[model samples]
Target: MMAGAQRSQTSFHFCHNPHAGSLLQGLQELRSDNLLTDVILCVSGKEIPCHRSVLAACSEYFRAMFCNGLRESKDYKVTIHEVSPDALQLIVDYAYTSEITITEDNAWQLLEGANFFQILPVRDACVTFVSNNFSAKDCLQMMQVGNMLSCPDLEKNASLCALKEFTTVSKTPEFLSLTKDQLITLISSDDLNASEKTVYRAVMTWINHDTRKRKKEMRELMELVRFPFMDKLYFLENVDNNNAVRKSCQDILTETRRYQLFPEEVESPCTRPRRTSGLREAVLVFGGLEKMEIGENPAVFSNSITCSPEPSTSSWTRVSRMKRKNDSRFAVAVLGTRNVIVSCGAKSRDVWLYHPELNSWHKLAQMKENRYHHKLAVVQGKVYAIGGRNLSSESSPWTSVEVYDRIQNKWTESVSLPKSRCGHAVAVVDGNIYVMGGLDTEYKDTSTVYRFSPGDSQWQSQTDMPLTTYAITASVLNGNIYVATLTNFLCYKPCENGGSWSVVVGVGTLCMYGMTVLWWESSHLWWL
Candidate 1:
């Protein structure tokens, strides 16, 4: 009885003090002295901490049991028994002092156990070690595991580190495994400010590849990842440093034309070859010209006509006109629904749909408001009436935005603009509504540009035009926003450092509105 009582007391003392002797020696002593605690071995082959009293209290023989096999086989080797002696000591101290001393060897394993058990000290200690000694490999592995474990802070750190490395050097085969979106996330990060120069140079060079607009798309993807404040300031500055960067990268790419930097361009899945019809016939629609001399109340003439991108050498023929005429600001947009052209603007509230085949006018309902000097854009079969003047006798700028749905045969009012603008040009580039070059309240021309996002229903200011001018024309061709003013044309793109615009070379224009665009493209061509 004396011996049994002494053994029970010794076992109790050992349970209260795990570090009273070597971990293995203490375990052997506890077995000899008496059973102090019961360690539950999960089916995953992981040992869990449990007091003997707690085990005794349970009806089941094991303190804990796995209902099913763990999903990951890697968890098998990461057991409490397999943990190094040093880590075991830390684990024991973590339960007692709540202070964990982590070492590199067992940091990950300890963290796994700590995370599984929801022990704060051990988990934190593991995090501290990993953060301080983070390597490329460690970051890569941790990024995958941490993200899965919902360890946000650790995942963020690992992602940032990997992205920083990707930016610093040309993305390797290993790094290229990251999605384009992920690469973009790193490029736009503020933490990598120190690595910006190297990262930007590498990223710019790598993405500027000539795999049929691949570089152009990468540039766009980078723009999308940009922080909102940075993009706003960048566009407001009116500089297109991308051209210079592109030029430099082009120079580098020119040397390495032999290398296949980008994956072969995949032909668009939705693209269908345009079927050629015999005779290449086209129909011409003419309307009233602007009544220049207001001294004479111009014959309430119906001049606004829907013009197609007709091939050169076509005749002047009248097809359709607006029901009400107010010096129709003529711009034609091809509707996707019926293969018809919609003569959109004139501030008359009425839209005339012209079928080139039928050569007839179909009058649609009036717009929400009268708009003039506005541009029309067709996006996903929806007609968007962008910036223009809300025509009234008082002559004020228009801020109201409207969209027409062909399927529903209705016009719905969208969010308005920040400013009432007129004579502005709008282009839908990658679902972003870019409003550029217009007159404000005072009718003073502007070079300011604003980008409207449908996702947020808000406007974000972007790069301004190089020269302020109203009645400018804007279009997106080959992923570049080309703006043509009365006298000049310029291409503006986002800068590499990312929050400003840089203008490319100025192009010469032969004439305004309907003038031949020949001078800008090549040498000279006559215009009527």
Candidate 2:
């Protein structure tokens, strides 16, 4: 009993003290003092004194070397041939202290040594350091190292960084040094910043780096370029003469020409090798009040259309004209990036869908009610038409809502609003439909805000507006809704239950009733 109790007490004492800071301090001091050092690791004939117990605990290689009856276990000396002395020294220090500084100069070397020893944490740290410091100049090398060490995420990040800065990266010697697979990986990224022409030039340079070796890969590679987006003249004059490009992408070039000359006959080929994945979105405005000559008023049925990159940029270019006149009160909503659907054409049940790419309009199925002053918002790619009046019928303003599925090409009924209202603003945020302040059944502006989810049948009331004024337009940005009234702009926080509307400064005041308000990321593109 005494022997058993003594053994338990010793085991408990060791367990309790194993992770204490004092033990780490003692080990650090022991390392500094070179006390009880059990082994010497030689790298390139340079010796680094180390404790075998610390090495064995921290590294699988050292553990196997010390515990498996290896020659180094008896001799207390192991020669490392794969890594340099500097990397070995860093590894030895990390084994004792559990920390090491990884810089650009020594990162690859340390990673190599760490990988060889199966020190996964050290390898991860090296990868992280390289990933964070990636630039056009060093990213290729970083990617190469990451690929060799089996760190896929690090390799991906490094390759993407190089692709984003391809114009500069392509001029470097490292660009030519890229393996065929590595270059393909760079080109396959969604938003590699280089234009199609620059990419073609870069490919030519890479192939020319060693013509005998890289010539075979030329055809297989040129087929990946998005030639349709490139200039037509450049393809005819420059790219057509290339024997490799002509041979590899002959079918693709013919398709590109068919798309250009006979656009309606053929669907555009969509092989974007290096197209910007980040959206290059622009807002298109159609049919509002336009200024006329001094003696005349602007025609009611007139043509005025423009698309701006942002809400603030001065550069606005003319685009296709709306086929039908658009009133300020009519509901408008964008269905994905391709289709812009306009409904409730001022008491008429006409619904027009506009295609931006083709710059053409087609009339879709009409709504159940011939509603004007109605609200429309898109949730999960389906358009929801909510709360408006039917001017043709003598019915009271609509409190009912319906969803239009693009797939079904028809109107489907949804949950009704809590109260009858018109000219209210509706916004879709976090997959919920929020109906805000508008004229109530009594024709008075109501301060109430209600929320509705797709699956739910009831409209749950949310935080009301700070003021009783009707919300003219609303747009969501970063999960927060910005509600604009006739007099002021208010920001609504949906997460906060009570009195979430806070006054936004510097917006000044709205004199006229604004038709629509949208929230774009870059403020520079916003003109109105």
List the candidates' TM-scores in order.
0.42, 0.52
**Lowest lDDT block of 10, candidate 2:** 264-273
Assess the local accuracy of residue 183 in candidate 1 as a C-alpha lDDT between 0 and 100. Answer: 59
- Candidate 2 structure, TM-score to reference: 0.52
RMSD of each: 24.0, 15.3
After superposition, which runs of candidate 1 have C-alpha atoms over 4 Å from their true positions?
Answer: 1-291, 297-326, 337-347, 494-528
Query: What digit string (tens of lDDT, one per residue) describes model 1 on residues 135-197?
Result: 665566677677676777777777767755544334444444444666566555444433323
Model 2 RMSD vs true structure: 15.3
Cα distance off (Å), candidate 1, residue 342: 3.9
